[model samples]
Target: MNLLLMVTIFCVMKTIRGISLQKSTSHTFEMQEKRFVRSLVNQARLLSDWTEWSACNATICGIVGVQERYRNCSIAGEISVHLTICGQELHQAKPCEMPCITNQAVSLGSWNNWGSCSVSCGRGGVQTRQRDCLQILCTERFLQQRNCIGQNTCPQWSQWQEWSECSRSCGMGGVKIRERSCQVRRNTRVTQVVVNDILKRVSSPRQSSIQNVNASLCEGGDEVAEDAFPCMTSSSCRRNWSSWQPWSSCSATCGTGFSSGSRVCSGRIGSSCLGRPARYRRCYSPPCWSSWSGYTPCSISCGTGGGYRTRRRECRGTSTRVPQYMTCRGSNAERELCNTETCPVWGQWSRFDKCSKTCGSGRKMRTRTCVSGICRGRKFDVVSCNYQPCPYWSQWSSYTCCSVTCGPNGTKERTRACRHGGYRRAPFMNSCVGEWREQTNCSMHPCNVTPPSVFDTFECGVRNRRQTNNFSSSLLRIFGGQQSGPHGWPWQASWQYKNCNRCSWSHFCGATLVAPRWVIIAAHCIEESAQSMNHDNPGDLWSIVVGMHRFNEDGERYFIRRAIVHPNYIYRDVTDADIALVELRSEVPLTTEVVPVCLPQFSQPTVNETCFITGWGYTGPASSVSSRLSTTLLEAEVPIMNFTACQMLSPLYQEHLNSTNHMCAGDPVTAATDSCLGDSGGPLTCQRPDNTWYISGVTSFGFVECGTPGHVGIYTPLISFEEWVRTTIENNTYAAC
Candidate 1:
């Protein structure tokens, strides 16, 4: 069988060699390769599982190479046929990554000195030493190690000593410990041993002999060894019992109940006591007063001294377990006063009288008698009579132009007429308020005098005439509804926000220049900003850009040095005094495109008075400021709404708005002219009789869906905070300058 196998292997080898030698076309080569692989079928059948892939062949750092793994075929009976049972290939190869080394000529340093052996005697110990790499990196390891043996005589342990007494006499928590020391065996005589000749020749030949003394006899192992075990004395083995404690309260609230008393057992754990450690006893408690019955009817009804009522209760309880008799406490009968209020003195109300007027609604007489004149309510009451329409004064017309262009002599007049529904009617005693014509003094400016230029002098409320490209001077008026001219509103400020300490600023809230170094803003804007302002360095986080209509314009920016919020302002409270002031690091230079707005001198604006609010706020209704704010500055004309009318527009306004600190501005009927998100902190400027603008209010808050009917924008009236502004400016003027 061996001879036959040899012949078959020889034939297969010869056939593989012949196919490899016959070089030919690509197709022929492929056929020959397949034949070569199949030739082994007769020699071997099924293939073994593939081995793990070998490391990359590349030895240099950062070089690409390939890896290979191989499988061997299982031997079979056939030797001449190809190995069809095996998979397509017996060898596998794949691309691999190579180790990267900084040094091109990577090599290991010389071996370091051998370290002390892990054991001082016997064998199987090792020593190690390491060297630092000379380059940034190296492929070889820094640590080198070798086997070592101890040279000194090994120490032997003596028998363990008797266990010491237990730490405690009565508790199982005590422990006992025993120790043994390494003692050298006694010798008849001491001796000096010379080093081995072979070791002496390898090292220094002049090495001296070592003396075998008691101190050097046991050097390999520790000097002592110890053992320990938990132990207890005879006293600790016997359990100790403690005196019983007081009994606990009865479990039941009343009548028969159970009470228990307990004692502690201290000694060996899990040991049983001679007697029970707990006991139970019967208890009894009586019910109190049996919950008194409801009061009886009063002896006398409706009197000055009032009436008296009495209730009766019984005491009854019995307990079989308790030896002592128990009874409920307190009196059996209870008394209380009732019906103490004074008796009704007024008689029943009389019938209502007839309608006073036949055509229009009017009140009629109604009366009732009150005995002794002592009654809880009025004696006579009256309600609506006839349901008929009445004549009333019509709404007043717009005030006509002043008789004179300027000066205190100028005056304006307005008029209203009586009306029955829509039809005009003659004034009469029944008509509401007969007087209709009204006149008020007015002044546009001193006659033949031009207001000083804002740039030449520090005159405020001045408009810039410097023309710019791609802007219309005439702007459509609507809240957040129209783009403003380049310099239409010189006092308008763009309060910018930043996401981080190093980010660029974007429109956050609108503001107005009230002074060279001060800008007024909404208190909420500080909290709503993305970046928190650090009090010590607030300028780094907050900045104001003024004189720019479009965001792309290179406007003058002033970093904030201090921000003073209104003392009464409360976050998220729309009714609160939501106003704040910002002090600039440096005073802003008055220019054609930059100027302060005049502060208001009156307590409130006249109803229906026209005013303008300017800002880069959102142009349309939005849920929040997250929507894009206007790219260019905007101004809108809104009429001053009466507090009564404004309040009736929405419940929120009714609940929060008042004439004192807050004012409303918007066309409630049209619902098309009101401030929106991002408009907060802007100005509400109304032209006074002098023809100059005055900041009547500061834009504080408005509905999320801006410009809606019955949701007028609310403002913080500067009229109410005029003194505060003046005081703050005066106090900070020196420091700010």
Candidate 2:
């Protein structure tokens, strides 16, 4: 076998490489080519193990020869062989002439019917069939398997018995249960069997399969079972209760009373419940009463005329308490007697007594007594008797001779006496009127009587002609100076309170004498004082003092008959039209010491002009209002500022300025001359080229402390109010000086 395999491998390798033995010698090849030769050797060994070999001659063939002949005749490939034989010529292998039956057809027997399934009740089962090979020389048998469906009926569970009695009576709950079994019917018998036993007994080959059935809990016992229904109870049953009904109405209106409510059992046939059917409670209605009111007025004033006083009350209650009017027991009204004292009565008067005075408004007296000792009314009265008119001044007698005849002046005298108008005159009766003597001016013809010049007549117009060379010193002294003239600024008037003493001029505001009876002042000054006094009659509260330079000196004080404050002037803020006119009760004398200031024309030009302000105000700025006003008149000169320039100095001033009726003046940037407090309503006078002085403005307001830098003084323009002043003075009467 080994030699034949070696020889086959050589032939195959030679054929694969297309190499011939005739051209080959002993030779070496590469390793890969040598491996290719070994693989072919391994394949040849496997083929030799599975192959049969045969040899054949003319008519007979051995097994090995048969294989050789089959291979030569059946295979479609080139054949090569190497043999070592001890004689005979070589020939190509051939097939023998013998009959063969390896590929012949055979007959088969009839098939058997399918067999029974292996299981009855689930998815796994089998049915089988078989057949036999029919050739006499054949021994093979044939078989087949097929799937079949089979299912047996499941056993049923019986109904459970009635539940048993509870095991416990109270507290934790007890249990009861019923029991049953899974069962099915069998042939000739009823049985309690499992599903597997039924499946085994059934006759159908496909019906032997079995299925499980759920078990049922047993009844009629106290033991708890898996499928048992619950039974809950105590050993003895009790009746159920319903909810209580609402309470009934109270029985009484004022005092304690009873009320009731009830409930019933829920189970109709049972009366075993523990509580009562009805509940009782106490109820009460609030008491009603009223309070006594105040007594009425007495009906009589005297003499035991009895009167009655009564009081009434009604039932009422407080919060949270309901009043019961019907149950209120006290009376609604009460009465008592009042005013029982006796009253006094007057007796008849005695005859009139003699007159107390012999003349001029004498009186007579009479007396009466309370008849009842307890008198309640007047007892005496008086009447006039022998009454006569009091004495009054008769007309003055003719003048007597002059005391002296002189060129300067002289005085003459006249005399009168109080005389009664009636025929009877009482001796030693005092005069009821004024003094009995009067005086007048008397002049001789030799005196020169030239009319006085305007400047000489008007003393307030006289300027302080003492010029100062040093401007700085002049500015410094502006706020501190003595009386400019003996009767300096005579037109200057002080507005005072009538209630103030004569020496308290510093407490007053200033004014200017525009007419003999009319003085112009700032309206706010009067308004402010009036508001402070809050008097019923403003006229009685104000008085004007004229003809004085010093605040402490006595002057001609006149009561203001009326003051006409500008209607449009507002008191809260400085404004234009701040001028007011005060009508005096009597006109001041037009002397060199008390002359009126000139009223400026409406067309007068005062802008940038030097003007003077005079007052009895503080001589210098002070922290507080100074009670000590300048004893001498104060005078300061300042140029009038243009309205536009004044408005630009401060927003406050711009907001309050009324240029048409107001003007500004002062050295605002220099902290020099300016009017101070208490100087309001004083004169701002300017002189014209003709040497005549005119009242230009009335002092209205200034810096709070006066003489402050960058602040100017505001004044009411007199020229603008010229018509108002004239109208006011013409409409009002002037008293004689």
Candidate 3:
């Protein structure tokens, strides 16, 4: 069995040799060569343990290689055998006469095609091939290995994995990492080894492992993964801020102050802001003041007593005309010594003039000159002189008798003539300043008479004395029946400065006659006039025109005894407490042409009640003072509005509405129905159920442009100032009714 196995192996070797001779590729040759070498190693192992065979000495040749002959060789022969296999030899011996062969060298078979490279790209790899020897006794194996190149590249970083968790949380800093696996692509089209094979051949000392990367490079790496992020943990992120609001009204009207503003941080949660939240800057608002006015005229003309003069100052803000009185640091007024000179004195009276009367009695006049010029007294005089009586018409004889009694009419006659003696005399005698004989209607009324009602004294609602002319009627028709006739609004008063040059009729404001001796006006009007004059007495400069519509025409003008402005009144960009009362020097007659309006009771009507406004102000918004002053009183009906609603109507109203002291009224939808310039301090009168008119409000101000749609007029509510009015009238002796 052993011999048969050996023979089988030898036969296999021979067959492999024959196959290798026909193979063309280096790979095939290398494979066969490996098989042959393995076979020889196995054979040698078997020979070392051989038990049934004896060694021989002979020149081993024939089919194998030749070697020198040996004599007396044992089973384990010491003879040298030259068996060439692919140009290599193996030392071993067998029985002599084993076929002596010549000692010749054998070349290796042609190389086969190279195998695939170990790597696809980027460097190291190996390839192998070999040829085979055909002899059985040859022990050398024919195989080779050489370096190879691959068309493909070695494995590299394809893509990185997602970042891992941070190393630390809630600290000054933290770290995070990510890794990628090396990969190799196979080059199947080229003479290269498979990717797996090339990777295996690399034998890299680096294990298949991860790489560390700086945590900052990772997304969201700056923040900790857990809620316990230590970095700026105590600090919270800040939100953005809006633009600053308008600076608040100055703490004081003048002097230094600070205006502060703020901003917010724009950072992520838990991030700290490294700056301040508020910023501040210095601010200054100096009081606006007028120059000191000239000294006023002395109070006394001539006397031992001295008179005083004064000057005043006012504070007007830069942005607005605010009346900052105390805000002005300097004294507003000053007084100094006035006129001390004595006046001229009149001399003694002279002889009287001749008798001036022709009958009954007469009078005389006398005059004296101020020749000494040291006294202030009258320089003229008068006294009775003539004593003789003149003969006039003597007493007439009694009537003969009554013609009738208690009838439709009755008459009685008497005859008389100029008398010289105790009887009738010549006709040439002079008569008194009247007719010598006179007759009049007698018994014009019956013996019994009825008293008249109080209403009978004056006419009410008698708007026009005659039919309106065509032009006025057309105007009335066009203006929605708002035109009024002369003396239509008896209580409406035109407020004017005496002989003012700015306007044609000296008309500047309007007022309502609430009493025979008192008129209501706006404080702002008085203040404005006083400021313009600078130290001039308001009363001296103003006059009240009553009982007339046309300011240029005939009207009862009354001197203003005094003007009492409300203490709380303010004349700023917005006017508040805008009310005042003016006392007339003399009382006006309460006739049909001049009457007083009723004062409102403590309780008043609700909003939306219809009321009437009357004034000689502008007929339209575009009319100038000279052209617009109505020759006849203008009247319009408006409804009272809620205070809040009026404020919402315009920004101007919002800034001016003093809810406690003001009311709003107007036809907001009508373009030509609102009170315009020159209407301030006019009356807003409402008629009660009894058909009696009551003064409800005093026009304070309206839009400068007059009748703007959706805009209304603001007035000083009379009811709100009822107590004030009563107290003011009672406290002031100058006020009379």
Candidate 4:
């Protein structure tokens, strides 16, 4: 019934009882209940198949069976609900009135009428067929049901106007992760370091014994650990590890030859430090090298022309190109092999004006070119050569080939990649092979090469557009103020000096100008030296082209003094922590665009309330990062924790999270999300009251495929080591001369 009519009926009832009905506490539910009653009545008329009772009047009472029994309600929207019974809803039951029995009325009936009493019992009902398909019976008798009379008329004229107040008490809920509980039986058990390297090292024959492995104890179950997931039970939990992930097990205890220490190693198969089977597994390759490890150089087809033969093995290179392994998935018989004498030939345009390179045999030679003088693009399938801006006439008529990338200021190639032979004589490896007729060189790389200008291509945008949307809508991103600023350009935010001229090349990832003569970046970006036509190699990758933001274009591409990734950044295993520190061939002037941000002051701001993160990642979720650097603010309130609180987050850091190694932050209650994508490896800068900024986290790691609610971006906390960053740069950096 409508709240108005119900109010009228309620009013009439109140008057009949000589009781005054007044506005009860601030009860939204009360008001909504009245609305709900009206909605139910309307839905009965408009929604259900029951046309017989379009306007039914019903009395709604709390389960207590008393008028004005409800205290009050705070939720908005309709508080009262209307039950619309369908014809199909009524036909099977014979209480015949099974759809209409009133509760008080039902209790007053006998066995024969009692079964009938349940029909539409007025509270709620159940209509079910008897064991025999032929006999249909239904009973609906909920104490909370309201009685709707015939023709849907009001029960009484005064019933609608009155309302009672109610309170919302806490529903059953609470958890506690007390300190002493999660203590990693450290004092009682053994603890050892099995998977301490960058990627969890496959267990060696000597590392298989599991005795004194002092397993790190997870201290608590009540609270979720930082970098950890909520534990479903009371046993143990760990999160945030230097190089470990947590996995679940039935026994609550890890076995020997398996990960005794609890670093839930994800994504690959293998044992932890003690050399046990992987806690959880997905790897299919044999342990050690490729199951093809016993490989011997075989002249299977031993041919002259294009036919070749070479041993196929694992080609472990760090480049954006799809790893040879990923591209060679499942082909064990036709493994990869390669010719060692292979050197990709180069073609030049105007000495070095164009950034050009070719990949063939299979893969089309994708190119990154400056359409006009601007960084836009157009590519052609041609041989390898320097990548240069197309000739002014090159709009449609002019085309050229490239072998290497050039520098903007006529400097040397910043990144030096060399593509060897594309065809692998071996089965799957991307490496070497001899010719018989032909063989896929699994070792030959660049199968899925990410060219500098690949983003400028048409198809990529279509594929990744959706991810971009998801990224934009993420709640974690909203809090970061997305504003452009006066706080100097990010490229030049570093306190160090750099020289990147955008005159000659393209295809450079990210880099930091560490000093007047040095720059730092991921080695994977410059893995290949250079390659030939119809063949792929790592060489075609950019040569540390510093200044140019757009791919395929050149600027002051600096020479690479050296590329050094932590020996551990091997792609497999827990690569979330793959970090590399690069040294540039030479530094550029510290202009407004290339200036540097100061490194974190040692030990200061060990823990702070707020921090900032910035990146050139795509504006949308799936999109590649734009050429320019953009920044966001991430302010998190962190808590100080002891050993167990820390260990339960992840076992690798029992020592780190404790007194010496690790410094942690974050709380599970806040559901703080960390840097998802587009922000990897960037600095997590903590800002203080005095305006000084300290690097707290290195955009380290997180699940590659993200989206867990409470999961946030994980960073390589800077507090763990003061001497490392300083010692590495000590003599190399000098404040502006």
Taking all chains together, each candidate's TM-score versus the true structure is 0.37, 0.37, 0.36, 0.29
lDDT of 2 by residue, 1-737 (tens): 35455446545544532332223232322222333333333333211122344534334211112224222211112333321110112232322322223334667688888877655633456666766556543333355567776554334456656655543342112334344455544454545522222213234445433222122111111111113222335433346668999999987665566799998876523124667989999776676565677877766654456678787887653223334523567688888887677665667777778988866779988887667647655566789976776566654544555555435366777766666632233345544455568898765434465433323333444333332122233333636333455565667788876545554433478888876767888888877764463322344456788877656475788776567788777755655578888766555788766768777766565577777888887677756454356766667778888889888888887787777767888867786787877788888888877776779888887745677889888888877788877765644431112
Per-residue lDDT over 270-376 for candidate 3, one digit per residue giving the tens place of the 0 to 100 score = 33445576777765577657777887888876667667777776655433333343275667677887767666667778887888885457888999887643666
> Comparing candidate 3 with candidate 4, which one achieves the higher TM-score?
3
Better of 1 and 2 by lDDT: 1
Per-residue CA lDDT of candidate 1, range 322-362, in tens? 54536555689989898776676777777888878754777
CA lDDT of each prediction against the hidden true structure: 0.67, 0.59, 0.58, 0.33
Clashing pairs for model 1 are 41-82, 41-83, 42-78, 42-79
RMSD of 4: 39.6
> For candidate 4, lDDT tens digit of each residue in 577-626?
34455554345654433434444556545333555554433233343343
Stretches off by above 4 angstroms in model 1 are: 1-457, 465-480, 528-530, 572-575, 623-627, 735-737
Give the residue spans of candidate 4 off by over 4 A.
1-481, 486-511, 520-540, 543-559, 567-572, 575-578, 618-673, 688-690, 704-707, 730-737
Best by lDDT: 1
Q: If both were scored by TM-score, which would come out higher, candidate 1 or candidate 3?
A: 1
